[model samples]
Target chain A: MKAAEKRRITRMTSAGRVELDDAVAVEKKVRVAVNGEEVMSLYCSPERVRELIVGLFMTEGIIEGRWCIDEMTVEYGDEILVDIPADGKVSLDRGTLISGCLGGVTFSSSAGGGPAAAGEVRIGAERLRALFAEFQRTPGLYELTGCIHNAAVSDDERIIAHAEDIGRHNAVDKVIGRCLIEGITLEDKIMHVSGRLSSEMASKCARWKIPVLVSRAAPTSLAIDIAERSGITMIGFMRPSRFNVYTHAYRIL
Target chain B: MKAAEKRRITRMTSAGRVELDDAVAVEKKVRVAVNGEEVMSLYCSPERVRELIVGLFMTEGIIEGRWCIDEMTVEYGDEILVDIPADGKVSLDRGTLISGCLGGVTFSSSAGGGPAAAGEVRIGAERLRALFAEFQRTPGLYELTGCIHNAAVSDDERIIAHAEDIGRHNAVDKVIGRCLIEGITLEDKIMHVSGRLSSEMASKCARWKIPVLVSRAAPTSLAIDIAERSGITMIGFMRPSRFNVYTHAYRIL
Candidate 1:
């Protein structure tokens, strides 16, 4: 992937030091504009610009499903401009700075909302283990640059979509964006991330009504509270053979 | 430390599932007010709230060293308010949302200015290795909650100040704030972090004029560029015997 840049530098290994070519992740400023109005500019890995935009809209509760955009163009090294009809009157001004490594902001929405995916979805312990194993096995941009975080969406048996970004939040955004643009419904899917699940992450799942949120890391207390309130099955520290179900344990058999 | 909260969770191991009390890291909103004016609120570990404010200011270029303050108080489960003279005219409105877990915003400053810690400081490789060894040994809140990231400032021998937070950026800010309030100059000291060193992190060290920045992770391409321009010693993937020097290598003997 073009997400990593090769740089010549001195490396120190266990045995000794040597000069070599190393792969360093590339982070760039991407200004996203909707209907000719500047929404915001953020530093992101430029590989998946389209997914970043679509996922941002889905997580922000902007467009519930496939959005009707008149035109969309990505000018490399410049910006990504999506032209919805002027009558669409989309305003992306209300953004809250998110906590990620490369600095990012998200369009904020009210916490008071209806659950988007409220139907009951259950999975056996072995099935959950297999899904996590799929998450662990899917290699992408992270192997080249150790500085990236990964996120993926899966069904009961296999992962459907996976994304890697400089920020875990963005990684989630990319996955959701891909699904939204591809017209895939997330009503009964599981969202797995490679970083800590915070309140924001849980809220994103709740907004989309995704029933199960899994991570290979721990969850913040606020995340658990939100998961409990939203009726989401929050599972963390997911390994090949084990996992911790924080809230809504009934969903996991 | 109150930073950790005990919660009964069902843990699944290689053997079977068991219900146990686990120590989870606490994340709360700490609102910071300057001169009785509400600046912004951040989700942070409740411990070292004051240092968080100071370190935030230091890294943001808000307050250089210890400044005049009439009153400052912290109320648990409430907000932190610091009253300077009305003439202080502190404005924290220019925050750029940082990419950290739990999400946060950082006040922005122009890249143009005098170097805060511009000068030559040399250190032997052995001394640097010892300092990094100390960094790996001092276990704190991270042991309880694997979700948190840690940042610390150290001398040639021992770690002077350390802070842990749900956000790696916030952790660095906490360490800087502690130094500012305690009247410790970081011109020659080293700043070490447990996460990837991004451009913002490098800029914070450059703003404070910390000569040597050591991390147990890789540095981003933009971070390396900023470090090289700022004339700071940037070292990453720091182990006892191995490390990668990204910029201004002359400082390493």
Candidate 2:
């Protein structure tokens, strides 16, 4: 993969003052091909393409894990091929193909139901506060453009994996994809994001069977309701010392 | 319309020190219905629902102006209903439904095709810088969340309409939607956002045929390329005294 170049920008403030700083950004295209057919084109910064692919697959529930990945190749240019170990009976649907330049893929849930995982999980509020404190200190790509969101996977006390993208969902997917490729179990991990907690975010965590979620922003009512029913611990407005436990507050000591 | 109720939050810095004052936040749900049927729900602060709805419509190209809106009502405690004059001859396709939460929505672009008025608009960089200076002074939501993105529609030196949302795209959409409902002409206005100039943002601006886009953040290479091809002036890292005019610099002087 080619490395992204950084540029120096001179900016003036609202007060009519000028300051110079360095900004990092990249441009690259990744053409996803399934069964030798192009599905969609993605223009993104050229880092973490493999993790992005894996994370996208898992979050979209297209493939279960590394076991389902028959063969995967990432070219130096703009192509990625992922062969899934699917039976001959499984057919690809062209109707679901959607093109996106910045965001991640959007998929529909199966007809029989909504999210498959149970709705409720539990975690300590203290742990969440600590995790968020650590999260705030971590350097992120967003602080560069003031446009990205960060997602991190953490155990009780420490964040294990983190990714940043212009989209919050993509950030989470990237981390999830990394864990899948590294053979890490998400059974007890907490997913943290810098954006608001929405129903979709909750669904992504529930789908992965992640037990806990902490966010620096507020949660939508639907997300709170979903978390309540799904048996997941949902915490929001997280800061270093205080946070709101929306669902399963009992998990927090 | 329901009145916005403010909630106070105490924020802490990364060093574990609490800030001096409490930040206020508002909560509201934006129900987006097409032709009387609810399609998607957005839970955001109640400050700018009207603009949001209008901007969304404009960017989606569902309606161009107030003439297209047969009736519009914002019922407190219920939902906002926008009745666009629909023609039986135009059949809407359900196959294009995009799902995901804020993060998901941020990454995905409207599949309606590129900007409706791509090459017909331009604005001077000095005027854009002046607009940012004035916009920053407006006491608004972002001063509280430190996470929201602001969107504004301006004509030359005057800002006719402005709105802020937690999501940058939503902010722009809200402004566009406002123009449609209020019968404001976007043909001569410039769009400004508090976030980066990504391809998605530029696409939305192009769709509206807004002549120029100014931002306080950096622009992706694709955004610059799209602006160059579309004849839209893309300005980034905008400050009161100086700004970078990436495309169509001739218009800035």
Candidate 3:
């Protein structure tokens, strides 16, 4: 697959040593330039090229004015080249973060969509678990390479979108961008991931006001705080039949 | 421990439901400013505050001139405030990454070290596994929270320096910085990480001219390429008694 490549490796077990072919995840640099300004270069699995850029720009607020994916030009190969044709300038002076609030808790100024507004949507625990299980099963990247992270959007019923990347945050960005371009509304949606929930992960979900965020790993303290304040139903440490809810338990009935 | 905190969580198991106090990894925003420019703000477990900055600045080359830990000012609390009081400046135009090489296998322009040099260090399979096993057991943060990534610098005999963080890259940076400040030589040393071997991770070890990189996880394709080109012995998927060597097998007897 384009996302992974088989390589020869020597495995040494207690009994003996043998040469075998192992699937290694493929990661390449994707340099996204907005207008004429070179924004940033990040490495990720070479898939979901468009979604990754859009989601990154939207969440990081790297753009100045209204933008759309239609204005993006992508060239995929050894490296991914993306040029944003909109008035989106690289003008988010993130350097001013120095003057941010000093409470040990600082949210990115470019928080997407602000905190999630309360909705009447509620999901049962079993349904949430099943949805996450289905989300895990669909992503073939992790099983193949063992180092990939997957992210998906779902409702109480089924998954709506999914993407995989070498980086968990990049996976999240890919899914967010896919949903945005596909005209999929993120409201009252459950965002599931295959990695730990960090502060940045929690904030990404908050940016879209995602109602519930679930991961198959632990959540950091700042992640829990962001979920609590943003009204997100934060769930983590999700196993085959169990999970932990750290915030907005009301939404996880 | 300061790296982790106990928090109330609702657990939903297949057998039953209950509320429990679970240890969650602590993550706080640490905004780093060099000279007077707010370079960037990141989230990490609050420890090794100085090592992290030095390692980060040195590895990424975010600063221009010489800097010292003694010239740094830090305020620790709910969050961390770090001001680099050196002739150091945050003038690295990483945004110009747009004009980088088009090969999908582009390395970062600020790659700390060009590559690992050929070294005379040779470690047997058993010895390398034992060293990694020792490295893994020493990080209490992971056992407490299961989300922390630990990185350590070690010789064939013993682990010399170690650090842990919520982010794997941050952990690696902390260790690198720790070794730098402690004046530990990186030549012929092995850098062990408790996470996937990604391109950036491989490059980080290469930057320090570390001859060996071992991980208790799988490696990405680009990582293998970098390791091979840099002449580093890359080992991954390390179990208690089993491991895979992907590059420079000469270093593993």
iRMSD (1 decimal) for each model:
1.8, 5.7, 1.3
lDDT of 1 by residue, A52-151 (tens): 8667764664432233422455777533344432223444332332211111232233323654456478988788888877787787767787789888
lDDT over C-alpha atoms for residue B191 of model 3? 94
Residue B234 Cα positional deviation in candidate 1, in Å, after optimal superposition: 1.5
What ranking emerges by TM-score with the best candidate at the front? Answer: 3, 1, 2
TM-score of the A chain in candidate 3? 0.89
Q: Which candidate comes out best when scored by lDDT?
A: 3
The whole-model C-alpha lDDT of candidate 1 against the native structure comes to: 0.73
Residues B140-212, candidate 3, lDDT per residue (tens digit)?
A: 7787897899999998899999999999999999998887766677877999999999988887787767899
Off by over 4 Å in 2: A7-22, A27-43, A62-67, A72-130, A136-147, B1-54, B57-67, B71-85, B88-127, B143-147, B181-183, B239-245
lDDT of 1 by residue, B115-182 (tens): 54565578777788888878767888777777888899987667999888888899999998787666
- Which whole-number lDDT from 0 to 100 does residue A13 have in model 2? 39
**Against the true structure, candidate 3 has what lDDT?**
0.80
Residue-level lDDT for B20 in candidate 1: 83
Q: Please report how far candidate 1 places residue B98 from its true position, in Å.
A: 20
The TM-scores that each candidate's chain B achieves against the reference are 0.84, 0.72, 0.89
On TM-score, the candidate that comes out on top is 3
Model 3 has fnat of 0.93
